[model samples]
Target: MKSRKFYISVFILFLSVFSVFGQTRKQLEEQRKKLNYEIKQVNSLLFKEKKKVNNALEDLNDLNRKISIRAKLIATINSEARILSKEIRVNETELKELRKKLADLKEDYADMIFKSYKSKSQQSRMMFLLSSQNFHQAYKRLEYMKQYTDFRKKQGEEIVHHSNEVQAVNDSLLVQKALKDKLIVSEKDQKKEIEVDKKHQEKLLATIKKKESSYKRELQSKVKAEKRVTAQIDRKIREEIERANRIAREKLKNAPTKPKSVKKNEFILSPEAKALATKFELNKGKLPWPVSEGIVVRKFGKQPHPSFPGITVNGTGLHIVTKQGQDAQAIFNGSVLNVLVSADGRKNVLIQHGNYISSYNNLEKTYVKKGDTVVTGQKIGQIFTDKVSKKTKLIFVLFKNTTRLNPSSWILRR
Candidate 1:
């Protein structure tokens, strides 16, 4: 009986440990799968475009971090699974021993009940009393009777206790079975995740192979063309600023008494332009795309040479590639400041909004003339598609006063 009680206590402790480990394994598996899914999503975003290649690198770094976390989680789960397996074995062994003990307890209880029935008659009680010769012997016999009854009660209690223990062992077995099922499912999911990770790695490799050569040459050519266009636009913007300053100076000189508050060096913005810039800034995220449904091919800033060693490309704004025959639209309501016709016969449109200006280059035909008031989303010109590549690209730029600013910063992050 003492050994049985000890085994029961140990079995309960083992069950408690098993339950905790199973729950931990389940939680860890869920976290691992979630991390794997996030990695897959980031990988997809990385290969969508050339301009976002750097973003992809950041995503890759993020994936690596997640993978590291997953590895730790997997190790933890494995350890828990091993612990559960061992505990399950222990439970099975304890259950077999408990069953054997319960059977022996049941036999002992049945024998006590059978013997009590056999000795229940009045004749048997008289014989038992007569067997005592003296009064002290009779008293001792009465005490012995009470002890026998108590022994029978104790045997019954032991049988009940053993029955309860058997039920507990059965419950533990059920729980262990459930834990085993969960572990199997988790292992299957882990294998699937590993397969997905391998596929993503292959995809990344393929992307590099397909893009490395042509992407390099294309990036170089685009960089050179962008630099030339930026220089031209900068020169034109400087010229416009000088012309405006000259006009302002003349107007100041002609005026009898200029306001004391207005400085000669300061270039005051027209009310209309100020209002337009304010409106544009107010609709930051809601700004219209320069060309509808186009993908940004070139981004703002200096980029490494794609093909040549130690070569680099610089961009002042963004270049969008769109379908053929797409019209470049005004992102905001503004007046056309200049219609540029480059020496190479390319057309560009410059729109002014207060002290800010936006330029759309690589256009084939202009729909809005210089000084024309264009509303937001209004078509300004049709974009010129490169015949060789069959790609319609528009060079879009923004400037504050005469200083160039990154268009990407002004546009929505998405």
Candidate 2:
């Protein structure tokens, strides 16, 4: 029983080790695949068009994104290689143990066979049994002989099993070693590519620095435009919140049982809306992207301006760079609260999911209008591609009532 327990424990340990390595390796491979896809998208979308206009800032942004993704890919490859190394080591250890166990079992079986051969004669076996003191003793001797034979057969079977295990472990080691080598080679190639991109990026930066005054003026204008759009959106959201709260309060005032005072600045949701909000909250970090395929060029919050050094730009939302003509889709089931036009004539659509509102800005045209219900992944508008810059970007924003939320944290990571 103790031997059986020990073998069971060893088997469990073997399974657990392989299981962990397999899961980690699978995840790394998936991450690497995603990064590779993003790289291809960046090249296809950003580099396909010949530069009709010379915009060093735009080029630098695209190159920076490519470099960032390449770096991630290298890191994932490194992790995969590490996992493979660990797996190979573990397999080697298991193989060694299996080999030793097989040898021990073979030796034990051989000794048993030798002893059995010494009593090969049936007549000698009968005589030995007859020499027992009584019938019960003879029966006991016969039972012992039968159990010994069964045990010897089992030992032979165990030897065969252990031998197979050793072979399997050896094969696994070979596969893992090959994979690790491949991953290492991939990592090196990615590093080289990133280095090349970095050099190109530096050249672009230097060129932009030569025209620092002009670029800084362009950045200032860009910042002002972003701020104007942010203010318009904020005003619209506040108006909607106030209007919704007023209606909710009126309804409660007419009711026989007066509830606690509702917050004037927040949305007073109905029961259905409350349920929807709960579901939306539960799905945080799992919301679909505003666009089907895109890379986030600008994240939420303040960061140094990409074009000009020593200048900070406050980004209220995510700027997702995508292919031209890509449709902006609703991230969840919601009603279109409003559709506002930016100063540049580009359109923006706002969808309300309970108390949470998501806005898609920089659209060429909007398909949904106010009060229109839209489901998850529903096409709401076409993303705008700047003719001069040749960049297609969607500015996506998320909010809980009037409070801003980072869209990246809420949306699923690509």
Candidate 3:
């Protein structure tokens, strides 16, 4: 009975350990998978064309940050796997101990029952009772017999309980062993991921080495492309703003009642337009990207050169890099104010959202024409990829009454 109790305690301890270890292993596996996916994305981006010299330093910095995070995650998972392995080993040893205890309990119980049966005889028991010195003694003997029977019953129950405990401990031990096997596999995978991450770091370092020569050529090309697109869009916007202003003036003059007041750029701010701008502002951090799935490879505003000193580039809006053949959509409901081709020959589509204007440049083709109304998320055109770089970048710009604003501040950040 004492041995049975001890086995039960050991079984409980093993179960507790198994549960804790299993949960830890699961968490480690999840982290390992996430790290692996991130590493793959970094590798894909790294191997794609040569790095952009202007953004190379910044990109390299970002990649290094990701690599650091991956390394830490791998280390954490490895530690967890090690802990699980130790726990599994301890569980196995405890299971073995429990089985031995159960076997000994069964043998002892069997011996006791066999001895009791052998010593029991109906005639002998009755005679022994009568042989007592007095009636009180006989009564006492009867009570002792009852006590002995109960003790035997209790012993039998204890044996069964210990047997059950032994089985439970064995089941837990099997479960722990399986979990340990999974952890081993996860550990190996983490090591492979770390190796791949190191390769990516090496590739980034190599790319950064040739930064000077490449920066000049890439910057010139980017500036030329940006200037062409910007000029084309600006020209179209000027025409539309003038035309809209003229129409509004004519409408006011033709009205039966005299105008209350007329301010330059004032008529452009219609109540509807102001409301839309307010809504767009309200969604400052929540606006969706013009393209569905991509990262903002380039941001809005002035940025330093990746390789040269005293060199900087100004971005009127944002440049998003997406997969080839991706579509550029309208960010909000607006009218297609203009559809023109930039000097670079890429199609540009402009939409007027109330007083604000949104532009989608570097399109291969335009789907909407001037004066057409477009709903939010409406597909306007497909983005064009640079053949030399093989980069599919879309130039997105936002304007209010001809004043340019950074598109990054308005759209959701990736």
Model 2: runs farther than 4 Å from truth?
1-27, 121-137, 240-279
User: Predictions ranked by lDDT, top down?
Assistant: 2, 3, 1
Query: On residues 20-117, what C-alpha lDDT tens digit does candidate 3 reach at each position?
Result: 33446567667666666655555454345664433554555455545454555546565576776777688778778878887887788789888777
lDDT of 1 by residue, 242-356 (tens): 6766775576676776624433323355556568789878876667778766556558777753223466767667977676788999988888878999877889999987667
- Residues 248-331, candidate 2, lDDT per residue (tens digit)? 778888888765655655788888888888989999999999887877778899997644557898878998888888999999
How many angstroms is residue 28 displaced in model 3 relative to the true structure, after the best TM-score fit? 12
Q: What is the lDDT of residue 176 in candidate 2?
A: 84
Leading candidate by lDDT: 2
- Over 4 Å off, model 3: 1-211, 217-221, 224-228, 256-267, 306-310, 406-409, 412-414
**lDDT assessment of candidate 2:** 0.82
Q: In order, what is each prediction's RMSD in angstroms? A: 17.3, 10.6, 13.2
lDDT of each: 0.68, 0.82, 0.71
Q: How far is candidate 3 from the true structure (C-alpha RMSD, Å)?
A: 13.2
Better of 2 and 3 by TM-score: 2
| Order of quality (TM-score) | 2, 3, 1
| Superposition error at 200 for model 3 (Å) | 5.7
